[model samples]
Target: MSTLEIRDLHVSVETNDGPKPILRGVDLTVNSGETHAIMGPNGSGKSTLAYSIAGHPKYEVTSGSVTLDGEDVLAMSVDERARAGLFLAMQYPVEVPGVTVSNFLRTAKTAIDGKAPALRQWVGDVKTAMEDLRMDPEFAERNVNEGFSGGEKKRHEILQMELLKPKFAVLDETDSGLDVDALRVVSEGVNRVKGNSDIGVLLITHYTRILRYIHPDHVHVFIDGRVAEQGGPELAERLEESGYDRYLTARA
Candidate 1:
């Protein structure tokens, strides 16, 4: 089984003043077939942690290491880390003006699989994934996220995840800005992939609504860049009732 390990990770961002600390000694792990939910308020460095794992150049890993299936992920490039089976579905997916969804998916698939999926099979796979997400086939002809609604962008991200079939997925606030129906569609897409023994999910969110659909194996409360609390579904229920204030106060 595959594993994604985050070991006492410390991250910072370059600034005119020097470096600004973001993630402070955050540690977590997700194994194949498991779903781990990270919930916290804004500016808790949850997205920074996700970007760090995906090897985004903007976030600098000041200390600690990230590994995938025992391989040193910290030393790899963004594309390399992706090819090694790590996927990050961003909260704000960028708009590629001229890149059609089909082309983008094909390129990503080729990069991850080290081969080109046959034209007929590629088309079929994309169509199936789009249909599973309730997206129209014409979406493949449209440019990625250009003029699309927030919900559409989120659904597109899940579609990519389904097609790519990564070993571990870090979904960074995917439920944000989505309507109830859109949320259900995205959650269903995620659930469809969960049954695969080779996939593990790190679902980061600020609300418990998504968790009601995903049902995490473990839930972690991240406050001030560190994991302040850890529990099962009960923790999510508590957060739904009391919010993050109690945990933040205890951490303070």
Candidate 2:
């Protein structure tokens, strides 16, 4: 089975003052077919960890290393990371004005696989994935996230995950802004992807609502850029009832 390993990772971002540290020595491992829930309060460096793994230019890895199946992940470029089977579903997906959803998905698939997919099969796959997400057929022709609602953008992200079938996915607060129905639909899409493949998942969220739908194999609580607690799914249930107040109090 494939494995993604992070060891003592420390990351920072450029601020007006100077480089400001965000992640502080995060260590974790995710194997294929495992789901790890990362829960934390706002500004706790959860998203920073996600972006750092995906090789976002804004988040610099100051020290430590990230490896995928023993290959160095921190050394690869963003697209190279993706080609290496890493995917990130952004918390706020950006709009791509000129790119249609259909074209974008196919192009990304081609880039990752190093081969253009057959037109008929690619079209069919996209159509099936969109349908599974309860998306309208016309959405295929729409420019990516241009004038789309927040829920629509999140659904599109899951749709990509389903179609691309990555080795690991870092979903950065994908359930945010989703209404109950939208959340259910999106959650089902994520579940469908997981059920069909041995895809590892690192789900970052603040609430336990999404956890109810997609149960994690492990749960991690982030406080002050460090994982303060680690446990099984029961930990998520405890966090739901207690919230992060205790953790925050301890950190203070």
Candidate 3:
């Protein structure tokens, strides 16, 4: 079984004022087939944790150990991380101006799988995944995330998760900018992956709405870059009712 572990993670970033600390000390573990939701207020370092795990160069790991099944994750490059079965659905997926979606997916798949996928089966798989996401078949020909709506871009992210089938997925604010219907679709796609694969999920979001569609096995409240509290789904219910005033007050 695959597991992702974050131990005493401390991360910082370069700002106008020089290296400012973001994640103070985060320690969390996600086992196979588990979904963990990280809920927090803005600037609480939720996104920092996600980006740090994905090895974004913008964030510096001051002191930490991030490992996947005892393998050193911090030592791997971005592509190496992908090939090693870690996935990050970015908060804002970038637009690849000239590359078509079809080409991009194939390339990514090839890079991760260590060889090119057979064209016929690969095309069929892409088509089926797009259809399942309710995307237009012609969208395969469009440039990645170019001229697409917010929902479409989010859907494309899920499409990647479904296709790539990573061991652990870090989704950063994926529910943002999605309408109710779009949220349901995206959540369903996530659930589909969870049910079909033994992958772990680290879902980072400020709101609990998406939790209704994709049930999290564990809920964590992130405050000032550290996990303040963790519990079962009931914690999310409490969060929905009381919001984060208590945590903010305590932090202040």
Candidate 4:
């Protein structure tokens, strides 16, 4: 089974003064077929954690290790990580003004698979994934995410996920800025991908609404860059009822 293991990870940002720490010895493990939710307030290093694992050059991993399927993930470049079956759906997806979705998808597929797919089969795959996500077939002709709605962008991310079929995925606040209908559609797409694929998902979110659709196997409360509490779905319920105030206070 595919698995991701993070051990005592410490991350920092380089500044004039010195290296300012963000993640303070955070650790977590995700197994195939399990959905793990990482919940935290703003500035708790949740996004940093995702970026760090994906090998973003900005977020420096000062100390610790990240492994995927027992291979050293930190040793690989961003492209290498993706080719190795690690995917990150960013909280804010960028817009590439000139690149059409079809072109971008083809390039990504070629890079990940180490060869270009047949023209007919690639077109069919893109069409099927777009239809599954309820996206207009013509959207694939447009530039990537340029002039797209928030929901459309999120759905586009899911479309990429569907086509890529990564072994592990980190969804960073995918529910953010999505309406109820859009949320349901995005959640449904995620569910469809998870069904029988055994794709380990690490969903990072501040709100609990998305959990209603994508039930997580584990919920972790992140505070001050470390996990303060962890439990099952009930933990998410309590957070909904009481909020993160209590947990933050306790950790403080």
Candidate 5:
């Protein structure tokens, strides 16, 4: 089984003042075929952890190591990390003007696989994935996220996860801005990807709503840039009722 391990990951972001510490000695591990939900209040460093693991330049790893199946992940470039089976669904997907969704997906697939996918087969796969995600067939022709709504952007993110078939997917607040129906649809898309492959999922969110549709095998509560508590699905249920008040108080 493939494993993604983060050991004492200390990360910081450069600000006007200087390097601002974000993640302080964070540690976590995810294995293929498992789903881990990270829940916490705002500014708890959830997104920083996600970006750091994805090799985002803004977050610098001051100390610690991230490894995927024994390979050093912190040393890899952003695109290199993708080819190594890592994917990040950004909290706010950026628009790619002039690049149609169809073209972008195919190009990304080609890059990851190191060769062009068979045109016929790739077309069929894209069609099926779109249908499964309840996306209109015409969506392929639209520029990526240019005129899409928040829900559409989130769906597009999951669509990439479905098509690219990464080994591990870090979804940062995918549930944000999604209405009930959109949320269900997006969660189902994520579940489809998980059910089809042995992909590991690290879902970061502030609420238990998405967990209702895509149940996590483990739940981690983040407070002040560290994992304050972790448990099974039951922990999520507890968070739903108690919120992060206890963790906040403890941090204080």
Candidate 6:
């Protein structure tokens, strides 16, 4: 089975004042078919960990190691990381003004598989994925995320994940800005992909609401720049009840 291992990861971002540390000695492992949820308050480094694993140039890995199946992930370029089967659904998906959604997906699929998918099957697959995600068929012709609502942007991210079929995916606050109906629809989209593929998931969020739908196999409570606690789904219930007050107090 595919495995992603992170050990003692320390990351920092450059600020006006200089380097600001965000992730401090973070360690976690995810295996194919497992869904791990990271719950944390704002600015607790959840997104930093996500972007670091995805090889964002903005976050510098000052220390520690990240590996996928024993291969060094830090050494690979960003595109190499994707081709190696790592996917990150950004907290803010950028608008691509000129690129249609269909072209973007086809290009990504081609690059990942090292060849283009056959035209008829690829077109059919795209159509079916859009229908399942509740997206209008016309969306494929529009520029990716351009003029789309927040919910539409999030839905498009899941659409990419559904099509790419990565070995592992890191979803950053995908539940944000989604209405209850949108949330359920998006969650089902995520579940649809997971059930059909051996895809490991690292889900980052600030609320337990999404947990009701996604059903994380493991939950990690992130406080400050490190993981404060880790447990099963019940941990999420505790957080929802008492909130991060205790953890905040301890950090204080």
The collision pairs in model 1 are: none
Model 3, residue 21: C-alpha shift (Å)? 0.6
Q: In model 4, which regions exceed 4 Å deviation?
A: 15-17
TM-score of each: 0.97, 0.99, 0.99, 0.97, 0.99, 0.99
lDDT of each residue in 145-207, candidate 3, tens digit only: 999999999999999999988999999999999999999999989999999999999999999
Write the residue-wise lDDT of candidate 6 on 94-155 in tens digits: 99999999999999999999999999999999999999999999999999999999999999
| Model 3 regions lying over 4 Å from their true place | none
Runs in model 1 deviating more than 4 A are none
User: What TM-score does model 3 achieve against the real structure?
Assistant: 0.99
Candidate 5: list runs displaced more than 4 Å: none
Q: If ranked by lDDT, best first, what sequence of candidates would result?
A: 6, 5, 2, 3, 4, 1
| Residue-by-residue lDDT tens digits, candidate 5, 131-239 | 9889999999999999999999999999999999999999999999999999999999999898899999999999999999999999999998999999999999999
Q: What is the lDDT of residue 171 in candidate 6?
A: 98
Per-candidate Cα lDDT values, in order, are: 0.92, 0.95, 0.94, 0.93, 0.95, 0.96
Better of 1 and 3 by TM-score: 3
Consecutive 10-residue window with the lowest summed lDDT within model 2? 243-252
Q: Give the TM-score of candidate 6.
A: 0.99
Model 2: residues >4 Å from true position, as ranges? none
**Candidate 6 RMSD to the real structure:** 0.5
What RMSD, rounded to one decimal, does every model reach?
1.1, 0.7, 0.7, 1.1, 0.6, 0.5
Clashes of each: 0, 0, 0, 0, 0, 0
**Once all C-alphas are superposed, what RMSD does model 3 give against the true structure?**
0.7
**Candidate 4's residue-wise lDDT over 65-123, tens digit each?**
99998899999989999999999998999999999998999999899999999999888
Per-residue lDDT value at 1 in model 3: 91
Report the CA-based lDDT of candidate 1 relative to the real structure.
0.92
What is the alpha-carbon RMSD of candidate 2 to the true structure? 0.7
